[model samples]
Target: MEILGLACAAVLLFGAVLSIETRISRSDRQLARVERKLDLLLEHMGLQEHDPRLREVIELLRNGKKLYAIKRYRELTGAGLKEAKEAVERLG
Candidate 1:
């Protein structure tokens, strides 16, 4: 009976830990979404300079160097090539 009680307690503890971990993961995803939204809002408002690459990208785009802009954006932000391209395109 004592061993059974110990096993039950262990199971409960394991379940609780798993539940906590799951909640933490969900919260992290939600936080990331919120942060992304905030960044977009700031960018749209021109109220914050979140990334130094933005100016360079804009300049490159204005200079008709779209490829270079994408490359520079990727270098500065470490974003994927496609993402950098999309971001640069969005700037215009």
Candidate 2:
């Protein structure tokens, strides 16, 4: 009877540990997702890294003034449309 009780207690302890670990992992994932979303929002708002030149470029793109074409962006900033699009996407 004592042995059976010890085994049951051990099983309960193991289950509790597993449950806590799962909850912790889920919390970590949620925190990571929130951080990524904040980064994207800041970038879209042209607030990322606080570069005034980037803000000017973003403004030009927002006004449809065409500061640079896709190819030109690659030439100038070594970034593609994916990077350039982030600047203007928030304005719209």
Report the number of the highest-lDDT candidate: 1
Query: Per-residue lDDT for 12-75 in model 1, tens only?
Result: 9999999999999999678767866886998798875546548888899999999999998988
Count the clashes in each prediction. Answer: 0, 0
Compute the lDDT of residue 35 as modeled in candidate 1: 60
Candidate 2 regions off by >4 Å? 49-92
Using all chains and alpha carbons, the TM-scores for the candidates as numbered come to 0.52, 0.52
Candidate 2: 10-residue stretch with minimal lDDT: 67-76
Which pairs of residues collide in candidate 1? Answer: none
lDDT score for residue 46 of model 2: 73
Residue lDDT tens for model 2, 16-90? 999999999999678767866887888788784554445556555666766453434445565446655553454
